[model samples]
Target: MTTALTQQLVDLPVIEVLYSDLDNTLLGPEGSLLTGPDGRPSARAAVALVDAAVGGLTVVPVSGRAMPQLRNDARLLGLSDAIGEVGAVILRDGRTQYEWGECPGGIARNPHDTLTATGAVDAVLDAFPGELRPYEPWHRGREGGHLFHGVADVDAANDALAAAGCGWACLRDNGRTGGWEGRSVRAYHLLPRGVGKAPAVADDLAARGLRPEQAAAIGDSVEDLTMAPQVGAFFMVANGHDAPGTIRTPGGMGEGFADAVLALLAHRAGATRDNRQAPAPAEGTVVPSTVLVVEDDEMVADVIRISLTAEGYDVAHVTNTAAALSTIQASPPDLVLLDIMLPEVEGWEVLTQVRSQPHTAHIPVVIMTARTMPADEVRGYNLGASAFMRKPFTPDELLAQVDGVLQDTPRA
Candidate 1:
């Protein structure tokens, strides 16, 4: 079923920036880069990302990986900015401009006196013994902050650090699926008290003159949750740790998840331009009409929401027939934008249910779908759909149809 967070994402009108976590969030289930049939990164995600960048969404990789690892991966993926070592190091334009202890461009203040508290690291190591091992990338890059792996018991690890009076915060990687036995191998990054992904992301956004609402963050673990408040939307992969109100993709890693987000961003960019030229509602008739959109595809649903909302309509969307019926029963909208193809129950059944109800019978329903046969139109119209609109429609066409439907429907 399409989640509420997914619907919310679809309704977003603009996404100026994208902040993402690496590892399981962007890679496949095997903890490697997701490849297509061609043995390279999935084309759908790659192309969509490229398209998003071309359309003006700045993509930044926010990861626990160290500088060298992040740099190599970013180069391979064509990404330019990255927050590495769980925000200890900030790389912009392929250069390290800020480290944990030092502030650059006066964007961030050093919250901690030292980048790495050796006593804290030693304490955790001494406590966990063989269970905790040094994350090698920090040593290779010679950067501050220490990352550790093989932390199956996050509580114990944190307790160990606390017992040692270490001045560090433990960020857990709940998204990592690899581990001995049936349990997953958990990883933790020991960051100084004031340095974290959220602050680092905020600093970067501020540098670009962007607000938190202008960006979206995607990740798979609790560590990534630190970035939730810093972006317009937060998405968690299906297999990752849960955060309240986070949109989850059906596909794990970067598969269907990244593609869906990129598609929405591209659509938003196009709709923004089209909306500028769109005609406004008639003067003095300012209160917008309420629209209920019933569609299954998150990407298409968002596109429709963006388009109709731009034309000054209050839009509500649902992904299946059950939700459509429930929404109609709870609060019947002025107009219903229905899609013929739906999950569980088809759109045809939803239309029948709406018409069968007393309160919603008079509400105008516009059937919008990719089904472009004459019989399909006849079928929809026969089932009480007020208008039939095929897919691949422009924003102008959608607004025009909605206006026509609302105008033809008489007020009760």
Candidate 2:
């Protein structure tokens, strides 16, 4: 589809936001565009990001695509400068901005040699009938690449290839499923080994005059882990609970990415506002409750804290994961009222951490957040949470859920 190219965004300050990887990260399973219930591209977050960039945040998408396809996607998104092929090609405002790491005199110079080798590789893939399905020829650099998604026995496939004089490796781990389930695979035959997504993002950020600490990276795969830790902040999509260095979001894919971005922006915005405003809780309370209030929003945290205290339960309030963990260590509460969105650390990570610890693992955690998706609730249950509740819930309903969980026998 046609996407509007952004005109000069001169209104906001230029803050750089760098993203690594496209598929399963920035681009959902469908593509870069996310579909809403009505089946149209959900541009709310994308528009928000664009507005944020125009307002002073610089947004850059760094991926492993070849120049041609990368350029196509950029045109579609109206992205000006993007780092492609993991920094092999850098496009600034729709032009080749800079070239570093296997570019200039490197990979791009040997596309022909790479293509020949890729043809040989394809021969091996073609040898196995009904075993591997090649989606299409993805030509970039010297090696031809193909994306596949299907069910196959790793051991059997390896053995078959070995028997057929062809060698193959599975780059995807447990995260490979769905269209690519047993069949989903990513194979590269060009450039050089050890050329991953992180270094590309890092180099591009440096070129853009941004520090890793000044930027945020959000992803949901082994590929993303390569760059997540290096950035100032790293976030994992909620579906990537098993993936390392990723903090779960209230929503999945586009929504999760949006949540992560907002969390950082909100934190930054709050820091600026804090200097001018007197430091105080949104609503101060001294009530007590056996229920622990674990919300990042100060107002919500205070309201719950005061309301629970007034209800005659010993109340403990903590605003962040570090403090909340410390509080739980000192004294385990009867229940945990958790918000899915939190600063620095996410609510799901906190819940996972709480459940992992023997001292507090059995305590029922009731998720309280604006994330009210069915998949999100199912994921919470799968993660061992007792019950999930959305935000703006009545104190009475909150109390009832808390009572029910506290009264029930702890799961072994």
Q: Highest lDDT: give the candidate number.
A: 1
Candidate 1 residue 131 Cα shift, in angstroms, is 4.6
Expressed as tens digits, the lDDT of each residue in 1-412 for candidate 2 is 0000001111222225747355555555466566532345775456435534533445566665666787788777766667665444567755564332222233333423432343433443554556545434344341223233344454555454445433432212222434334444544322223344676677667776877777767667656777875676566765554764355665566655555544444343333333353323224322223778887654345445443544457777777888888888788877888887789988888788888999888877888867657988988888888887765554445656766676573433
Which run of 10 residues does model 2 get worst, by summed lDDT? 1-10
Score every model by TM-score: 0.57, 0.48
Candidate 1 residues 222-274, lDDT tens each? 87887998887888877678778877766667664565464555456454755
- The superposed Cα distance between candidate 2 and the true structure at residue 410, in angstroms, equals 58
Off by over 4 Å in 2: 1-15, 32-41, 86-88, 93-135, 140-190, 271-412
